[model samples]
Target: MNFEDFIISPRSFKTESWQIGSRISKGIKEGSIVLLFVSDYRGVGGDAEMQDFTGVRKEFYKLSQLDFEVPVIDLGDLVSGKTVEDSHYILQEVLSACHYKNAVPVIIGGSNDFAFSLFSALNFHQKNINYTQISNIISLKQGESINEQTFLSKILGSKNFSIKNYHHLGYQKHLNETDSIKLIKEVQFDIVRLAEMMNSTEKTEPFFRKADLVTVNCDAVESFNDPFSMNPQVNGLNKREICAYMKEIGLSDNLQSVGIFNYNIYSDNQLNHQLLAQMLWYLIEGINIQRSHPKERHYEMFYVLIDDTEYAFRRDVFSNLWFFGKDENIENCIPCSRKDFDEAKKGWLNPRLMKI
Candidate 1:
């Protein structure tokens, strides 16, 4: 069967952008992993004609030629009908298929709303799924419209899913509405402010550890940095900085999947596409690194032979190697018990590097 037959473009513009045939051929030759590439038409409307996919198709074909194998699947046509609920159902079907096949889903949509169906799918498959989502907007008030402010809000407003496992990263003061802030706090999200995210790397570490699935909305990049995104902002991180965080987080051995959304062609210049491609490259590179270096090392226990004291104490090394203890005090070297020790071993740690 033809692999391109499975490819669905939501709009003429998206089809025009793809290089499907060559991409499919190269993907097959490379024995690449299956990756769903959902492309959407801009605006809220009915099904549109499948236009010529020359520009974007060439890019996908070129990307398929990389040494790594990646079979490109499409779900752009699933969002049919006038209701947002229809788009939601289409997203669910696409993601459910990905989940069944153990494939990664890469969605490029008209707005951040593309994530709602995926979110709903996770909700449906709640027993077997875990989500780690990141968005700039904090919440969607009851009557908010689908313009620039309410994109993330709509997802937030959707009722079926629980926000207990959600992680809201890079929230800006100016962009979020007052009601959104209240709702975010009410939902108990681990909010990592844009300033705090940039202030220190260690401080932002918790957000990365919270999930198996990670979603990045392109608008998270600073307005100046990613002019092409739907709603760019002055306070957000730049493309390089955001991509670095993605790389570092993707290095985590626990990540199951990832998605990038809201990359409107009309929003920016040609530079946006290049930036998006680079960000994706970072993600793929990060996953490759994690796959190669699967094992995470830690000092299980230190058999310190204290000759002067005439005792060979088996002190359990609870923390990672980098732990220098809380401050410069030797008292912090208290022996760790089994329960506490297991939690400390979550990430890689080097000797002489411990902090609060």
Candidate 2:
């Protein structure tokens, strides 16, 4: 696929020699982090336009590149098709191309519903996908059109997609329907409240550790000055907390794709743009750090007996991350936290971990 045909080239931005943008390549490279922007917000009742991400690019390009060696590419803004479905098709092709080159595509802009495209594209390459989403609202409305309210239904209810695990994080109890929340739990899928995600990323880090795809709805972020998201809330993940989670998303061992959607493209606030740009930087930094870790890892194993059964937990010697399993193979184990291990030693187990 000649990717140029499907998207506009990013506008050139001035950057110092030490800045990250100065090191960004315009073409995709193997094992690189690719940025793709979309402006089709029709799903949320906004018209498509040739949106200028100059503000974001300018801020991102100016940040320090540090010692990171991972290749980064700017594929530019994706061209909105005549129809929303057309946009999805084009995005799927572009995402597939990136996957073919072993690159991770971080999609920016567009309505949150475009996440369906990310899922479809990855589903074609692998099965049993582990998807994690950070959003303030949970809607399961049934509809033919793919909008923010009905897209989750389409993904979870669809017979064609093979989702091994799904985690919905940062959802507010007041914003979500009781039935929808109950339904998600009845299926044994993980759904975390906004309170559980505040201050620290330790408990939630495990959710991102093995995810194959992750998406963030900007509505889940708290707005300041001008609105930060299309559907901004007064209470949501603050700037620091959101950046911490972005890094966790990047540190995923099995990460394949990511989407940051429902952003306020019309915001003129420099701080909002800077926040978004820094979020991307933190994500890239986490990816670089994860890639730098040794392929062969060492773990300290501990066993806890509960109700006549023994459970195993392992702690990584290098990263100090924890995992739970019944054996020594890390691949067969589940990502966990120190809190989980402590609770286990007290003869208590997290039901969610048992379900997985």
Candidate 3:
């Protein structure tokens, strides 16, 4: 597929030698991070006409390169199709191309429902996907048409999509429907409240460690001077906290795709643009840092006996990351925290960790 046929080149921006934009190319390279902008917001009751991303690009382009080893490519805005379904098809094609090149696609500027397209495209190449989403609302309203409120239902209900695990983070209890939250719990999926996500990323880093697809709903972020998301909330993640989480998302060892959706495309606030740009920078920074780690890892094993049962834990000597399992085989291990290991020594175990 010719990416140029489906994408409009990003507007030219002047850049200094040390800036990130100076290193970003227009063409996709092997093992690159590809940025694709989608303007289709019809799912969220907005028009398909091109949304100006000049503010974001300007901020992103001016940021320091900061020793990044991975290539970055801006594929520009995706052409909106006649119908929303058509737009999904176009997006899938572009994503497939990125996958073929062993590149990670960071989708920007689309309605939250476009997450469905990201799932569909990745499902074609792999199964038993681990999806992690950061959204303030968890709506499972049944509908034939896909929109922000109903897209989660479409993803969870589709038989064609093989989701091994789904983690919904940053959901605010007051904003979510009781039934929807109940349903998610009933299905044994992980649903984390907004309060659990604030202040630190250590506890939630495990959720993203094995994620294959991670999507962020800008609505989960709090608005300051102007609205940051299409449906901004008064109580949500602050700029610093959200940027920290974005780095965790990028640090995922198994990450394949990402989407930043429900962003307030119409906002003229430079702060909002600057925040988004910084989020992207932090994500890329995490990716570069992870890539620098040793390919072959060694672990230190520790064991604790609880109720006549031996529980085992392993800590990577290189990364200092902990995992819980019966043995040393990494596949059999579940990503865990030092806190979990500490609790186990006291003859206690988190039931949720056992379930996973």
TM-scores of all models?
A: 0.64, 0.98, 0.97
Residue-wise lDDT of candidate 3 within 1-356, one digit each (tens)?
55468789998889999999999998878899999989999989988898889999999999999899999999999999889888888999999888889899999988999999999999998999999999998999999888888899999999999999999999998887799999999999998999988898887888999999999999999999899999878899999999999999989998899999989989999999999999999999988988888889898989989999888889989888999886656966888888889999999997767873
lDDT per prediction? Answer: 0.50, 0.93, 0.91
Minimum summed lDDT over a 10-residue window in model 2 is located at: 1-10
Q: Indicate the residue-level lDDT of 32 in model 2.
A: 96
Per-residue CA lDDT of model 2 for 156-222, tens digit only, reads: 9999999999999999998888999999989988999999999999999999999999999999999
Report the candidate with higher lDDT, 1 versus 2.
Answer: 2
Better of 1 and 3 by lDDT: 3
Q: Write down the lDDT that model 3 would get.
A: 0.91
User: Mind giving the per-residue lDDT tens digits that candidate 1 earns over 1-356?
Assistant: 23234455433323222333343422222222334444353322322223332333334434423443345433333333344544445556666666566555555544566665556655565433335555677656444344334445655556755644556777787777787777766766456677866744455554564355677776677665436555655666776787787775566445655667655445334456656666665666566555565253334333222223221112324323222233233323422233233334543332112222
The top-ranked prediction according to lDDT is 2
What is the Cα-based lDDT of residue 239 in candidate 3?
92
Question: Which has the higher TM-score value, candidate number 1 or candidate number 2?
Answer: 2
